[model samples]
Target: MKSITLFLCLFTYFSASAQESCMTVENIKALDAQWEEKNLNPDPEFFKRVLADDFVWVHNHASMIDTKTSTVKRAEKQAANEGSDTRSRIQSEVKVAITGNTAIVTGFTIVDRGPTPTRYHFMRTYVEVNGTCFLTGNHTMAIPEGE
Candidate 1:
């Protein structure tokens, strides 16, 4: 009876942990979608809410935008320059590991493709602050032309 009870408790704990991990993945996916929409529409308020105040965006070209305000402004400017058709379709595979209230998400983002299709792979890290998730940093690597 003692062994059975212990096994049940351990199973329950592991099940709950797995559920939490799944939730974290879902949250990351939602975050990615929100960012994509923000980039497309260029809403500073939405961008601000999604990203941490001290968020920093490191472009694949080595240009970096530090601060959420600057990042949003930059996104707005880029959207304006590209017109309404500005679409950044990201193929992100998120892996989230949670520790207490914080989770680390690592993923690749593939951006901007026309009829011919060109893509860039970026390794991004996200940190959760006060129950809100924000992109902390990133390092991008160019994939092969065919890939």
Candidate 2:
């Protein structure tokens, strides 16, 4: 009876942990969707809630930007682009690996806009700080054709 109880306890703990990990992945996925819909729509409050203060974003073009200021700047730049006026859709296949309070998410995003389509493979690392999940770093690479 004691062994059975111990097994049940361990199973419950692991099951709860697994659920939490899944929730974290879903949160990150939702954030990606929010970013895709309108980068400008993410407020500073949201950034504070989701991104680490020292977050570094590495763009596919090899430009590196700080998350805090760059979040707004990126939105502004996107707004200025002619492509902003066109409707674009992004689909991502995200795989998240969680270790303690930190998580790494790697995925490929395919974006379609009118007659053009682009694909980006990206990896983002996130950490839980002060009881909130924050994006710490990111790297993106463009996938060549025929891969």
Candidate 3:
């Protein structure tokens, strides 16, 4: 009877731990904002911290694809040029979903850096490992003018 009781207690504890490990929407939203900030500012350290080693990003209707290394390199290059980036981004219609240790965030963003505003629909995937969240995948599609 004591062995059975011990097994039950262990099972319950593990179950609760699993539930606690799942990422919440609020958590993912905050993380998503960090991603947007990275885009706006192109900070290499922030990208390094949030992006997984094998992260992949499909940018703007497959115009280009970038890996974690490439993304960091691009940020470094951008950072080298002083006062070049003047982009401002606004995110809307954002939604987040989570399954166990993984989260998916979808949103629309309008960026004003050129003569006119460019809009995009984007999705980001994040995974929690050892209680830390890392961006694993990203895909974005540009919305054409007037629609």
> What overall lDDT goes with each candidate model?
0.64, 0.67, 0.88
**Could you give candidate 1's per-residue lDDT for residues 1-147 as a string of tens digits?**
999999999999988865553237678767766766676666766766777666666765766545677877776776667634555656666566667655565566655645544465655566765446777655556566866
Clashing pairs in 1: none
lDDT of 2: 0.67
* TM-score per candidate: 0.62, 0.64, 0.82
Compose the digit string of candidate 2's lDDT tens values, residues 9-58. Answer: 99999888655642376776766565555542434445555667687888
Arrange candidates by TM-score, highest first: which order?
A: 3, 2, 1
- Model 3 misplaced regions, further than 4 Å: 1-22, 83-86
Instruction: Write the number of the candidate with greater lDDT, choosing between 1 and 2.
Output: 2
| C-alpha positional error of residue 61 in candidate 2 after TM-score superposition, expressed in Å | 5.6
Cα-lDDT of candidate 1: 0.64
Off by over 4 Å in 2: 1-23, 38-45, 61-66, 76-86, 113-115
